[model samples]
Target: MNELGSRRLFFKYAVPQMVGLLFNSIYLIMDGVFIGNRLGRIGMAAAAISVPVIEILIAISMALASGAGIMISDRLGRERLGEALRIFKASILLSALVGSAVALLGNHFCHGIAGFLGATPGIHDQAVGYLRYIVLFSPFLLFSFLLGGLARNDGRPGLAMTALTLGSLSNVVLDYLFLFPMDMGIEGAALATAIGPVVSVIVLLPHFLLKRGRLYLEKATIRWKDWLDILRLGSPSFVMEFSIGIITFIYNVAIVKNGYGEIGLAAYLVIGYMMLIFLTLFLGMAEGLQPVFSYLQSVGNHGKNDELLSFARCFFLAIGISCYMGIVLFGRDFISIFSPEEIAMIDLAEKASPVYFAGFFLAGFNILAISFRQSTGRTRSAMAISLLRSVAIPPVLIGLLPLILGRESIWACHSLAEAGTACYIFKTTRRNERWEERWENRLPRYTVEDERTTRSGPSTSRST
Candidate 1:
């Protein structure tokens, strides 16, 4: 595809996936509403408390799928379909195994954390009941996310969209049935969430089995090196994504220490749902950009790619602006869905969310930077960004902010960390060119794409 064609193709897949995922987001919000309305505030709070874990699972799944898919696409361009296919198959197996373990182990861990999130005796059983069903469905959730990523990279974003949409919609219907029709209580809500992914998988299986894509999982492709590569490529993402859980735990502590309780928990949950929406958009763009970045590199259009990266930065700025506008205009509407009980809670959340999301504009930049680093196989650079932004920054901000500014400083950590991460990302953008060059010659570019016309900027979404 030419420059215009490539840009068009990028939007084609990006927009639909965006819309389809919107439905998925709505379903989550709806589930929260149903659970909150049916279950008591503590029960609702318990489910809300599980947000970090949910996001962590999502991040891990995305890391594996997107990271592997990025490499697979690059390999396909290089005509190493065998290696690509091997990685694809290995990712699925690894994801399933890991997901299964999480199902078994995650429940008890969640039970341990429940007290912190406000799961008292009254709501305790309901909370654990909710956790149980979702744990059982972990494999499907893992499969759904991985398959969605694979479908996107394997050149059938429609398939991924179908899977995601089906899963989201099915979850809503099943939620109503399980929660209301069958009167399964919190367990019903959990079951619905689990079932959603199964629907998604059903939509995706046909595409892979039919061999309609350039890269796919084949029986011959399951190999250790390939699995290692997927893990290697995915590790930065795993760090970046899973750190959300770690950081969120920190945030929860801050919220509690700062004295919010179930009220605080509910407010955070409201804010979290909105964050998820913004995060999904940010992730979608970064993911969509990855394949484009890889494709351009393979074809030797580095300069033009540099231009594309600049344009993407500009484009991302527009996204940030839109996010800010969404928060300002619809923050109340969004939060009310989760915490309809207290107007004061809504007002407080409204005040905090904008500050938290103000750095959202910068997050896209961080995401862009991270995407570039990972796509080109610059593992060290990728990992540095991941550790700094995901692990290091949040904790440092949480630790110092409280001591320096007093307890309320806890509330400031989210925005403070985001701003800090953005600064580090900006610095990396400058130094990363040299770093990328170290891997430049190491990864063969000419093997794929019409590289002659394809321009790659500094490389990865970071430098790109």
Candidate 2:
């Protein structure tokens, strides 16, 4: 990583992650498409409404994974190979415990949870049925996600990408089989998603077991300090992932309350699914960049770290603008894939698409800002950005905008929130130098001798 040019390093990590994430999103989109076509509009709405419940679990897994992964990356960068391996083992064990707890609670409260998420009577039963299976397999899904992060941080990005790809491909195959051949309806889509992570776990197990990188699975006690550190670093990521669920829930309630009803909810789902593709680009880039940023910081390569951030800002902005333009030109066709027979739903989604997505042009800036902070261990700043963007801002805008500007303004809420957040991020970036300076002290400084010594150790630790 230190020897490579900035652009080369960016592409080396970001491209595979982007491609893998894109492919992962394909099966998810496929699940939505199959459900929309086979089970109709209410089916699509049920799937969308269930997202919050799913994301809550995913948020927990990601929080633990991202937090521990960042810590592991930093430890390896500091030549603390043994410490890194311990963090990895502890992370897996904690994830399993959390997954077990969720499986027990989530399955028992599936119906209540579905109703609490604002599922209308028409879709409530279906939502409950779909959610049950998703929660039942929580352990596999959580571990799969956690393992991917650890593997990527261990300098095995290719393996991580491969695991995600294989799992998603299997999901697509299973989605088709269960939904069409077996005629299982919405339940089949849920089961397909639940099963994908199992495949991921299978593919990723070898990275640790075979000792492909600096980090390998080993016996480790769960230390409170380690868990706290992981949670502190990872809390922002959890919020980032959790925000999607919150945003979806807010939009669903807002659309329904305004009398737009199921068609509007269905419309939101279409746009949301398409947005997922764009989100994957930003998130994949951020995840890919995290280890690089952590490693650079650990090795005291501040100049390279800043340069990479600059490149990320420009790269993400260009991608975001290109995506919004593409959406403007081809949105109707995209929406049609999900709701081919429902002209009203398609029309509603198409109309809402531009207004709802205007923020895409500026979203990359905000995402990169949050990612930079998280990667560099600016946990407080990262958490603040995530909370404001996902938690605080959405509700106020979704609630107040419609009251003042009428229900049509509902579509503008997300756009306005993102634009506003971009301004905040710009200001925060300028003022963050002091905090960055403070955080820099905590990371180790490696000299040439230290690097050589680290490399020559029993289990050589090298920054990729």
Candidate 3:
């Protein structure tokens, strides 16, 4: 990593991460397709109802993974292998404990949780059934994310990509078999989703078990301070991911309140899948380069950091533009893949796409800014960005937009939130950069004065 150039490093990590996450998103879409085709609108709606639960699980896992990953990367850069391994082990333990607790609690209250997630009586049973299987296997899902992230920080991004890719492939195949051949309903979909992560964890285990990288499985005494630190540093990532669930939940409620009912949810489900794919791409890029960012900062290589940041800015900007354009042009076709027979849902999603996705061209940039700040240890800045975009702004817009601009404008909430976040980031970043520039400009004068004082002693300094 120290010897690699910025461009080479970016591709080496970012490309694999993007491909792996892209595959993961593809399988998620496949799940929707199968559910949409096999069970029609009710099935799609039920799955959509359960989305918040799934996303919350993912957020928790990512939070742990990201926090520990950053710390491990920093430790390794400083040649502190022992500390890095300790953090890795602690993260694994935390993931298991949290996953098991969630599984137990979630299954016990599956029906209630489904209802809370806005599952109507029509899809309540299906929603509970799906949510049950997901929570039941939460441990595996958490492990998959935790281990893959650790692998990347351990300097084996290829292994991480391979593990995630294989897991996703297994999911697609299992989704078909369970849904069609076995005559299982929504539970089959959930089962396949749960099992995919088990495969990912299985593949990642060997890498660590064989000591292929800096991190390996071993007995280590966990500390409360370590857990707190992990969660603290990883809070931004948690918020970033959790915001997805929150957004979906809020949108579901808003749609229902507006009298759109099941059909509206079905349409939003398709749109949500589109959002997921683009978000996965942006997140993949951010996560893939996170270790590089952390490593550079640890080594005080500010020049490389700036170069990488510039490249990432351009990359994310291009993606954001392309995503919005592609969705605008081909959204109808994509919606049809989910439920070709449901022309009404397809039409609704088509119209909503342009309005809802208008600001996505800047969404990637916002994600990049948050991840960059987190990776470089600007935790407060990162957390602020995550909260503003995901928590503070979107909910307010979702509530106020329809009342002010009329009901149809509700779809524009996310776009507005993205645009608002971009503006905030742009202003703050420019301000910080200007401050940095002024400090840099003053450094030479300060150095020269200090040298003159040293040569002439205290009397000369006083005379001046």
Candidate of highest TM-score: 3
Every model: Cα RMSD to truth: 7.2, 7.2, 2.8
Q: Over the full model, what C-alpha lDDT does candidate 3 score relative to the true structure?
A: 0.88
Question: Best lDDT goes to which candidate?
Answer: 3
Give the runs in model 3 whose Cα sits over 4 Å from its true position: 119-125, 258-262, 440-464
Question: Which rank order by lDDT, best down to worst?
Answer: 3, 2, 1
Off by over 4 Å in 2: 41-49, 118-126, 433-464
Model 1 vs. true fold: TM: 0.85
Give the per-residue lDDT digits (tens) of candidate 3, residues 122-234: 99999998999998999998999889888889888898899999999999999899999997999888899889999999999998888887788777777888888899889
Q: In candidate 3, which residue pairs get closer than 3 Å at backbone N, Cα or C atoms, i.e. clash? A: none
Question: How does model 2 fare in lDDT?
Answer: 0.85
**Model 1 bad stretches (over 4 Å):** 1-6, 49-52, 103-119, 260-262, 406-410, 432-464
> How close to the true structure is residue 395 of candidate 3, measured as C-alpha lDDT?
89
Better of 1 and 2 by lDDT: 2
Q: Write the per-residue lDDT of candidate 2 for residues 161-272, one digit (tens) a residue.
A: 8988999999999988998999988888899999999999999998788887777777766688888898889998888877777788789889999999989987887888
